[model samples]
Target: MAMSRNEILDQVKEVLVDALGLDEDEVTEGATLMGDLGAESIDFLDIVFRLEKTFGIKVPREELFPAESLMNNPDFVSGGKLTPKGLAEFKARMPHSDFSKFEANPDINKLTDLFTVAAVVNFVERKLNQAA
Candidate 1:
């Protein structure tokens, strides 16, 4: 059974709230996991684990967030910054993310700024669809 967008959002919100110890109201669709909800890298792991259990779907860490690997790649990072190719690949991988602000001065450190609650929902939807 394919879950609707709203269903996905609700499950994501619950997962985030549980993982981050946040209130339900703070887990809106527009909320950024790190910025708005205060999610750290470790929190991301917890969220992924919860999501996998809740949805019964497996999620590869690299598939969901490739920042760490990308940063280590010489082609992706040169002069301590993401190359044009790197930015393009990031955008391609994270279509649900809003890169308008980050496009001008892309910083790998600010990668969390791109992760919104909607992005997680979209990711879950894609994975569920693939499983179906």
Candidate 2:
């Protein structure tokens, strides 16, 4: 009884559209939640909550956004920018996110901006797989 990728994306779209007051068209897989979709930091919490409710899965905040963990790791950050190792780790952690722009500059403060609609789909899939 696992959900297909499209099913997950559709549910994710519903949550994002309702939570952020976004149009269905704007919540595409490549759409960055913060930069492209106008999602603020507070909206992140709402998104997570709605995803958990819709999917019946417990997604810890850190799992969706690991800024706190990254900041605390010296090897991951230095002088407010991501180290080479940090960039690799970030890519590994968030494979679903589009890192094209973020990789160019790698600003720690703007890390959340890397989150795309596809990332939510990946997260939900991982959580569901884990539960199974």
Best by lDDT: 2
Error of 1 at 22 (Å): 0.5
Instruction: State the lDDT of candidate 1 residue by residue for 1-132, as single tens digits.
Output: 678999888889999989999999988887888888988889989988999999999988877876777778888877766799999989887776778988888877777777889888888988888899
Report residue 3 deviation for candidate 1 (angstroms).
1.0
In the range 12-99, model 2's lDDT, one tens digit per residue, is 9999999999889989898888889998879999999999999999989887887677788999999999999999998887766778
Question: Residue 90 of candidate 1: its Cα lDDT?
Answer: 90
Clash count, one per candidate:
0, 0
Give the clashing pairs for model 2: none
RMSD of 2: 2.1
lDDT of 1 at 113: 74
Tell me, by TM-score, which candidate is best: 1
lDDT of 2 at 51: 91
